[model samples]
Target: MNIPSLPPPVTRDKNALVLFSGGQDSTTCLAWALTHYNHVETVGFSYGQRHAVELEGRPRILEKLRQFSEKWNRRLGADHIVDLSLISHLSETAMTTEMEIRVMENGLPNTFVPGRNLMFLTAAAMLAYRRDLNTLVGGMCETDFSGYPDCRDDAVKALQVALNIGMDTRLALLTPLMWKNKKETWQMAFDLGGQKLIELIVSETHTCYIGEHNRLHEWGYGCGKCPACLLRKRGFMEYQSEKKPI
Candidate 1:
């Protein structure tokens, strides 16, 4: 999971709207944006997914984040939770539907929801236009993606282009984790807010696809076998191992 560091963090003079999901990656992205953006707001969706309960923890996560840094929270806007149940109805994937989680011949898994990311980015862009924001941030990553076509770097780049052209506005789509692995993702959270932010992410963020939170793994509370949980635990373990004293 070792990878080169990103060139540099972008400093945005304008506000940033994050496509948050109250999950590990999105929380990390939110923190990342807070460190760089002058003003930051989060937007999440209630798409009737299996893990819809994850949305329940958004407010608490924000509260803790706000408490962590008043300077960052001063410009934080309210979380915009959109009702996107139609997205769930339109998709027949495991994430939004009851289906076996298996990788298909096309390299996509049952968790892959076609056009979900596109729809999300489009919605976030529209919201950004209304808010006069110039940036849309997401936590999508290709390095440790779980067979999701939408999470690919190429797809995200192409969608950004199409979104800008369709909206007739110049909006920068920033995927901070685009080239980073899960281990690097953990490290980024640590680098951004030190140990406090890392603790918040580990204890508060929800990344379990099946919504299991009782049992705690090294990464956090999850079933530990689902794709999401496995990736998180492995990344966390790698991050810890790499950070250990020689």
Candidate 2:
């Protein structure tokens, strides 16, 4: 299948504003940016997550950013972590706090953060306008995400269009992992920086919405039953076994 093309690049600097979430996908994108783009700056949100445990690891994520930054030096600019908790005020979703993310009996997982991608992208757009960045590297995906509606390709395209009009300037949104499952995503991490990134991510990156920090259940912080954990296990198995789908 032909992957959808991003809008043509506009800014001369070719600087990127990444919607980083301190997860496997975003970290890989951050690494990908270092090898691909002329410049890349990241932006993360703290919008009252159901599990604030990851919030505590934001500094570590930034340090990961610095590890890459020291290599690129002046080419890599500042990595910004925005505190956009006001966004949760717009919606009362379970991702906003400890609302006991419920399973809908026979439907998608309850950890879905509605409008999360929309809000994140919009915030990136606003930041990009200030930086005059032409490209936005967003890691949101339907491939192996939290099953949020806004993570769909259609939603991304719509946001691209709306953001262009809203900013009165063209912005090309690049999704490096939109077509890859978790294993492929993890492999991309390995490819970009070898096994080190994967080990660091598995050890540091937090994906649990239920707020499990201690006890070291299985792979990382999350319980093994949740979708995120199941996907993590599957991906880690595929990575270790060399049976990656992609």
- Which candidate gets the maximum TM-score versus the true structure? 1
> lDDT by residue for model 2 over 103-168, one digit each (tens)?
666565556666777888888889888987788887777887767778778888878887787778
Candidate 1 residues 108-208, lDDT tens each? 77788888888888888888888878888999998998867788777777777776678877788889999999999999999898889888888888998
- RMSD for each model, in Å, please? 4.0, 3.3
Error of 2 at 92 (Å): 2.8
Q: Which whole-number lDDT from 0 to 100 does residue 49 have in model 1?
A: 86
What TM-score would each prediction reach against the true structure?
0.92, 0.87
Which residue pairs collide, candidate 2? Answer: none
Cα deviation in Å at residue 9, candidate 2? 1.9
Off by over 4 Å in 1: 1-13, 244-246
The 10-residue segment of model 2 with minimum total lDDT is 1-10
